[model samples]
Target chain A: METTTLIGQLPEVTAAGVAIKAILILAIISAIAGFGTYLERKVLAFMQRRLGPTHVGPYGLLQIAADGIKLFTKEDIVPQHANSLIFKVAPVITAATAFIALAGVPVFPDFTIPEFVPVLGGTFVPSIASDVNVGILFVIGMMAAGLYGPLLAGMAQANKWGIIGAARTAIQFLSYEVVTGLSLLAPIMLVGSLSLIDFNEAQSGGFTSWFIWQQPVAFVLFLIAGFAETNRTPFDLLEHEAEVISGYATEYSGMRWGMFFIGEYANMITISILAAVVFLGGYNDFGFIAGWIMILLKVAFFFFLMLWVRAAWPHVRPDQLMWLCWKVLMPIAVINVVVTGIVMMV
Target chain B: MENFLASLFTFQGFAFYLFSFLTIILFWITVMSNNVLYAMTSLASGMVLISGFFFILGADFLGVVQLIVYVGAVMALYSFAMMFFDATREIKEKNTNGAVVFVLGGLSALMLVLMFAAPIHSESIQALYPMHEGVGNAQDVGIVLFTKYLVPFEVAALMLLVAMIAGIILAGKKMDKSLTEMMDEDAGEDEILTQKDEK
Candidate 1:
């Protein structure tokens, strides 16, 4: 009777656990988004062989905090001619959507609320806010939702260039999304589970056990798609200052501009987490605390690499970006999916 | 039956209903939006909702595929096309048709009716249990795809190859005549002017 009582409540407990996990994950994502600025300022100095930002605090750790206060206390201004609703809503949406997408991810093996929760009756497995079982789909939806921030920002600005920039950004993001999807599909088939936790667990056994080894082609395609989807270097044709002049982010100021920055950083972090979870082993570095450490380092490394690429490479043509997705990434991804499926099956 | 009923009453189950409702609304918005970019957003939302439904069905692979492929790839395609074409030309690019819409509506209605009635006319309804086919694990999916489904897999590859060839031919032909020809024309004109001046 006791066993059945416990078993009966397992579903509810799990559900509550998921809910708690979702909140914690979102908070972590928010902190990372806020802290990443500090990390960048400090790191840029080492990379450029020059002192980046000093005097704010030791190594300018307080620089980001100081900047935050300045932006927050500064006068909030809206152009009299702007679309009030969308303009105001875009930035918050951008940041919120980016953070929302982080819910499906599992940071530590047991970190996502425990599988079950204890209740007076027994234990139950409640869903984290948006597990959706189709979590990959949710992530995609949320990421795509983030794009609206730029779209609306441009539209609200009512400037010709702003509109054009937004238009170009929309097309660029949509184009890359296909390659990202196809690239992600290869792994979905490999793990055979949509759950992020399932995918993470499958990637356990050290380097040899990683999915990247099993599916190198997919990994390459995913990286390329990730670059384009986020509007990073080589795929940063949307903003090509020589041409579009900052893409959809033109005319953004204060917190509004910060939203775009936050969104980009959030996406970068999310993708790095994905790279670690899907390809590199997440939270499984063979030692006690190593998994968490390794995942963090790996994510930071990839994100820094993205920044490095941003500083190093020049922009690509809009047409070239499209052709690369359809011609290069998409085709390769499809083939990889086929091959991976065939090999795994065999 | 009891477990199935339990799932329907549970929190996870309730969330599914919410996701489905949101998905349906977004899907319509996507279909209704005149702007291609807006349409893509809506479509992405719809796919997300469908992915949630897949989660309810316990098909983990299918759910992720829906998210990664639909959101990551298909939505991207829509956005890219919108960006390339300049989504501002919504008024000019009204290529939609009413006749096609009605036909699609009728066809979908027929499909819906057939699907709804499928269980009513068959023994399949009486034995409605989760089909825990051997196709649960990666290995299982692999074996089936390589062996039993080998021919279809090969066919997909062949189709992809044909598409590639067609794309190359089409792309090459278009570029050679227009941008390249125009570029060469100005150079040729400059050279002729220079030659005449020198003479």
Candidate 2:
């Protein structure tokens, strides 16, 4: 009786729900982006056999908070030659696009507020924010659109390093985006839906039902492309410190710089989530566990894996990055899609 | 505030107004900005606002495609702005040909009038032909493009292929000469550095 009552009283998914979801997503993701930096430092330090950020709160738990304060309090600097408006707006575009891409991602399992809760009782919260039908395409497009941030930031600064950075940003993002799209295509074909939630459901049967087993090539290609897409290590020639001093970000300072950092971390999370949902069995409970917890674990594993790779490997040069993207990854992804179509037809 | 937000999120009447307002503002910015980079940025945002309109109108596939193709592929003008032109240089619009501008304005005005006047008839025509059953937006678009518009789709694809080949040839022709020039410049830079060290 209580369950039925709660179900009946549940608030429909109105505009109000969208507003609440947007707020929750923005707050949680920005916080996660901050926390991710601390985690990355800790993990990379451990891999190198050193203590990382142990000065702040316990295990440097409050380090992100400290960093946040510093970032906020620091003076905002715009170079004399810089295009001030775009230089300022560019970081915001980065951060905004990164956060916007999360709208289609199913971050958690759906849930409802209990009937006993006060004014907001029986409100149903979905796994995703918008849950648009064309979820994956939208996410990829939004992330690709984030190229403007680095491109504009680089040119506006009037620095040679910034120009090189912007040029690399364009080449790397555009090329890898092809691999990213093609690599994901085989899986999308198999699942027959672009919605991340649908992808999750398609794999919910078991580990054996996962698309990774069938489309392993595509999964690996997707992983590599994703790393490049997020400008992670091994493909992060856009900002290799020895070659370019922080690249396009050399002229930015304070919160503006922090926004770029947050945007990068958010994109990492978005890629991790996408990989987990599409390749690994997403949000599906194992033998005896709950779904949401399993999804969390999967996402955490991908996150750690990124940090681990950063610690272990050096980044590729710009030429090598392009060569790998076009000659190596793109062709393989194309073949994978053709093979997938053949097998499905058979 | 709550009600306003509720309506905005639902994308009722207010949502359309907001999108239209942004689109108009961005359109003006795109045209009126003197900085080429800023103009490109505004144009991109204006395109995005148009996609937002498509999304609100329930054409999810078209919206995503607009983002991917127009915003993602074509509007990579930032690189050109960086490479070919001075991004920070002020663009003086001195060549405002009055006759051409007048004719273009008249044509666009006429088109707009026709669009508004024939809206009812177009709405009826749209209602007369609905999408096929048992498919989502993407699939619906795919089916129509493959079946009904197959010849036109293939023709577009061929045109794109020709364009891609032309671009590759043009870019490749420049690469060989530039590569040699870059190597010579690098050697010169190294020589200068060594001479400085000796001094």
Candidate 3:
């Protein structure tokens, strides 16, 4: 009878366990987002042959903390004519949605707490917060929903530049979302499952087993579309300061602005995680290393690649960005999907 | 208190109640908001909440599709609202439609109550495809969608294509006028140049 009761309590314990994991993931990921800004500045500076943020701490490690304090102490300003409520809520939406999407992502391998612990002992925590069988779709849907942040923020501020930025945000996000979906579809078809865990297991053998080998075109399309989705360089038209004066974020200040920044970096991390998990081998071990470590290495490489691309490339014109998405990348993605389907039949 | 909270959480009815509450509230917000943007936002929220119901009911594929379609793709409604109306200004709803609104609202509420009271557990009700234990929801939905509902699916796809064509044609009409005006101006300029050369 005691054993049965203990077994009955298993689901509750696991639920509590995952809830804890979700909180931990949120805290750690947001912190990493803060640290990522520092990494960006340092990496960009080095690429340009200059030192970046050397004074704050050793190699500017504490710069994120300094930036955090500054942002916290800074005056929270709301424009006189602005729709204050929506403007204020907008950044939170961006940040919150980004974190919420992280719930579906498997950041690390699953683990169980030791039985030596008190109340929550022997509870198993899955790598993902909620493994909701429709994992990829849920994550992508959440990310797509994140478009509202910039959309509402720009409109609420009532600035002309902000309006233009918001319009761009709408068009850009909507367009690339199609490509993102289409490019991912082929791989999803190949895997025959939408669950990220299944995708991970499909490529568990080695680098040779990665989807990038089977569906290189899809991989390339996804990467290009991802760059746009994350609002990264070469497609950063939404906030190209030269043209649109900071775009959707022109009027935002203080921690409100910091929230948008965090949202952006968090999105970057999500894209990287998706690419690693979907195209590259995800949480699967190399010859010598463990699965978790291998996953981390893959994630780190993708993160570094984003920074590198940002440093190396120049921003594209909005027209060019639109042309590429609609005229070029999209057609390629559709063909790739068709070819993949035909190949599968054979 | 702890037990109450635990019971509230662990009860299956709690999720249904929570999702239904959200769906009703957001639906009301969508209908009643004076601001077009707010109305559209709430509409999207309500749609998402509806998807939440699907998720809770174990129709994961349907839930995701609902989100991707209703929340994501159908945001054309939002863009139209933003473009056609001044979003910041409140729309003054005329009092002339008060009786119509009241009757409609009442009828909807009555219908909802009737729906709630209906015997969903009736013995005659049966699932088309019996649950194949261990098969994922997506595969099940795919099997049914492709095999049984293929005609309906194709019709839906055709409807979407027609909608796309209509949207393109509507947008193209606006561009045509400007292009013609520019062509006329160039033609007049060419006439003037030719006349000057003859002189």
Candidate 4:
């Protein structure tokens, strides 16, 4: 697995064997995804002045791990009325899409390790699955693949309520996805390259240098659309337990339910990283590791904000959801796009 | 060993095989299916399978655009029409008379031979095969579409408008009812236009 470094310096080391590298990346991401769930509940609990999970482990760190074991061991029951094939595949689809999403993300600068366990001092290489020049388009297309997950889950579950939930999901996805694409368009225009590294470098200067400053309208639209994309409360129509009883996830229980839940939080994490990259100067800070820390803080902040909004607001009506997107968010996003285009060109 | 298998079931080789299989299934249904709607759906499926082959060939934009435009839009519209016509098992075979069937069978044979017999040449559609191998930026696509492909792009747009107009006309008397209800729902600036048109 020996390869030349980007700087054409000394060859890097290999702590991890070649055969195990990609598998390790996938395993780590899956583990981290489960861990993120624990972080969300603990953080949310603390903000609410509760002890979170004193029973599970120290500060509830083992909650997600315990839950993970419980989920895997649970029975995957299929409803007699359901189209079992599509139902079974739906959760797996929802889960795997995020890892492919990692391909387009940059966890560390120039750190995509073709060979793991670096030859030199721990700088592996670029931290992406692919150094795709057209990374942004791939991300969007991947995002579309994500829409089928919930749609299939809802449809294949075969409840009348499930059909309604699926329809809501489809309509909701169509509407909010428009805003997400529109908002991202401004940044794409700003950076001109579809590469994440290129986008990262565009935000290099400092706090003042962030794209958020130059394109505040685009920034606001992105955050709002990001909220809807993750289906966090205020925007979470997909799983309102009180009304429609779990929306698209009505019939799912045990590990199947857990998969959907974790997939959701992982999607939130992915979008959090993306929003940080595009608008908030991803891993770029006032000083050294401060940039990376800044991104972490921003991500945690967005995660917390989602929790607060969840507790704070009620779900909107299905018709209202479509109207909000088509009438409100889409128009605002369109305006942001035009203004961003004019500003960039001028 | 790896190269041999890679060459044998080469990504392109498997993709082409899949495409041909689907195409055969589609044409078989196109002739034999009891429902016209199934034939149309099969046709769209076949087309999309071909587009997947296009991706294997590394014609990334062509593959995506083919799926987006044909499978997504064109086929969707065709399905809407088929739905409107109430596509059932009976009427799909409605037009497949002995004479018509013979003519279409002869045409299909001619098409199959022509397609296979065409001189095989390769400019390497494998341009974007390994994923992320295409000029993506939207800017590249924009430039090519607006500059070199401008005439065709404009022509496509004009053709779309014509098709839409034809669709509206063919869609019939119920269109007024649907349009007015939609107009009622969106009773804004367009209401005035609809009111004037109604008179």
TM for every model, in the order presented, reads: 0.70, 0.91, 0.89, 0.74
Q: What DockQ number belongs to candidate 1? A: 0.20
The residue ranges of model 1 lying beyond 4 angstroms of the native Cα positions read: A1-13, A70-93, A108-157, A167-171, A174-221, A240-242, A287-289, A319-346, B1-13, B20-24, B27-43, B72-130, B133-172, B176-199
Candidate 3 structure quality by residue, lDDT tens digits, A214-329: 99998888888888988899888888999999888999888999999889888888888899999998877777677777778888898888889999999887767877998898
Q: What TM-score, to 2 decimals, does candidate 3 have? A: 0.89
Off by over 4 Å in 2: A1-11, B1-10, B94-96, B127-129, B174-199
For candidate 1, the iRMS in Å is 4.7
Top DockQ model: 2
Model 4 reaches what TM-score against the true structure? 0.74
Question: Model 3 — interface RMS deviation?
Answer: 1.4
Q: What digit string (tens of lDDT, one per residue) describes model 2 on residues A171-251?
A: 887779889999999999999998887897788788899888988999999999999988999988778899998898988
Candidates in order, interface RMSD in Å: 4.7, 1.4, 1.4, 5.9
RMSD of each: 7.4, 4.3, 6.0, 8.1
- Least accurate 10 contiguous residues by lDDT in model 1 chain A: A1-10
Per-residue accuracy of model 1 over A1-346 as CA lDDT, tens digit each: 2211111234443655565656666676666777887777666666677787788888777888887887667667776766565567778867887878776554433432233544423333232345544566557657766776776677666566677667676677767777777888888887877656677678766678888888788788888888876777788765567787676666676777777778878888877877777887665665444565677788888988887876667778777787788778788888888888888889
Query: If both were scored by DockQ, which would come out higher, candidate 2 or candidate 3?
Result: 2
| Candidate 4 global CA lDDT score | 0.67
Candidate 1, residue B152: the lDDT equals: 100
In candidate 4, position B68 carries an lDDT of 40
Q: Judging by lDDT, tell me the better candidate of 1 and 4.
A: 1
Sort by TM-score, best first: 2, 3, 4, 1
